[model samples]
Target: MRVLAAMSGGVDSAVAAARMVDAGHDVTGVHLALSSNPKSFRTGARGCCTLEDSRDARRAADVLNIPFYVWDLAERFRADVVDDFVAEYAAGRTPNPCLRCNEKIKFAAVLDRALALGFDAVCTGHYARVVDGPDGRELHRAVDPEKDQSYVLGVLTAAQLAHAMFPLGDTEKTDVRVEAERRGLAVARKPDSHDICFIADGDTAGFLRGQLGEAPGEVVDTSGEVVGSHDGTYGFTIGQRKGLRIGTPAPDGRPRYVLDISPVDRTVTVGAREELAVDELVGVSPRWCGPAPDGVVECAAQFRAHGEAVPARADVSDEILTVRFSVPQEGVAPGQAIVLYDGDRVIGSATIDRTSARAASPA
Candidate 1:
């Protein structure tokens, strides 16, 4: 089998490509140039896909003695992932760029191109397992829970999973670095990338401001009293607590969290932390890993990438997914993904659209 290994200039990906070579699958390493201006994407531990990362990937591929090439996907990434990210935030929803990258760029674009070029499968260093279940190929959590990345990959469909490979899924991060060092790979000591890759300095608000510019707005309480002001509604997200320039403190002396953002009216609503809790979620653009569930299925829903999975009942109808949590969840912002799981197997994923909290009883 011919395999296209995506070497991301990181320890995990280098090791994954080496394992593919050792397994005797005619392997070819490809580094994705995601940013046209690589210098702007940051180097070192903070981010990835920069000029330095591409060079590192090439050197790693040379060490493995595999045919190497670089695929420039900057335009596609900007249109699908970067642009979508800013638009989602501008519309008052928190978008997960990692999930969007996996859905639109890696799995969709890369996999399509790999297959067209006659590659049997596309392999990566993602810490998620692809198991051949009785039904078909199913995506599962990695053995190393601390490094598991299945949440961001829950957007993959059945066909994509069929031709996807994660050679490092069962290995720990420490062990992967050791293996890379043993294989004479320079990136064995490379620091893992974190935060948004495109935002080099880790200042997300500042980056958004540069793109969307300043649209001064008022921060009001739930009762519609103005308490503070902000440069733009895009700078705030649901459940954000700090950095709100409120002139007066809350009457209860407790910190206020952002409860809502009306981008249309440029108004941000603030309230107590308890006001952020919601028991119900409605999501759209559902993508299943295997078969779609039948009617309402008992499952667990994960809102954030590393967030705890809460037991919930999920129902899909008319291409919409609705989940009811047994326990109310907080920090569930719209435009984020709601990934459903059956124990360790990924059931499906959907982009959160809205949420509802049951009315409180008169105390």
Candidate 2:
């Protein structure tokens, strides 16, 4: 089998590619140049897709003695992931760029291209397992729970999973680094990238301000009384407490959290922390890993990438997925993906459209 290994200039990816080579598969390493201006993006051990990362990937491939190439997907990444992130923020929703990158770039674009070039599968360093269940190929959590990335990979379809390879899923991060060191890979000591890759300084508010210029707005209470003023509503998300800079103190003398953000009216509503609790969620654009479930099914719903999975009852009808939590959840913002799981297997995922504060009933 011919395999296309995506070397990201990181310890995990380098080890994954090495394992592919050891497996005796005809392996080719490809580094994706995601940034149009590599110098502008984050550099060094804290960033990815920069010029330094590309060189590191090439060196790793050379060490493994495999054919290497670089593919520039900057335009596609900008249009699909970066632009979508900005737009989602402008529309008062919190979006995860990593999920978009996996859905639109890695699995969709890279996999399509690899298959067209006669490659059997696209392998990556992501910490998620692909198991051949009785039904078919199923995505599962990694052996190391701390590094499981199956939440972001939930956007992949059944077909995508069929041709996907995660070579490092069964190994721990520490062990992967050790294997890389033994294989003479220099990225064995590279620091893992954190925060957003595009935002070098980690100042997301400033980055959004640059993208969507300042639109002065009023921060009002639930009763419509103005309490503060903000440069832009895009700087806030649901359940944000710090940096509110509210002039008027609450009568109860408690900190206020952002309850709602109306981008059209340029109004931000602030209230008590309890107001952020949501018991129900309506999600749009559901992506199933395999066949859609019939009737109501018991599952665990994960709101964030590393968030805890809560007991939930989910059902889909008319292409709209609705989930009812056994207990109220907090800080569930729109435009975020709610990944549903059955034990360790990923069942499906959906983009959160809206949430309700109604009382939760037993599932």
Candidate 2, residues 128-170: lDDT per residue as tens digits? 9999988789999999999999999999999999999999889
- Write down the lDDT of every candidate, Cα atoms only: 0.93, 0.92
Best by TM-score: 1
Off by over 4 Å in 1: 40-45, 360-363
C-alpha TM-score for every candidate: 0.98, 0.97
Q: Where in model 2 is the C-alpha error above 4 Å?
A: 40-45, 359-363
Total backbone clashes of model 1? Answer: 0
Candidate 2 achieves a global lDDT of 0.92
Question: Against the true structure, whose lDDT is highest?
Answer: 1
Q: What does candidate 1's lDDT look like per residue over 1-363, in tens digits?
A: 999999888888899999999999999999998887777334433788788888889999999999999999999999999999999999999999999999999999999999999999999999999999988999999999999999999999999999999998899999998898899999989889899988877899999999999999999999999999999999999999999999989999999999999999999999999888999999999999999997999999999898888999999999999999988888889999999999999999999999998776111
TM-score of 2: 0.97
How many Å off is the CA of 241 in candidate 1?
0.9
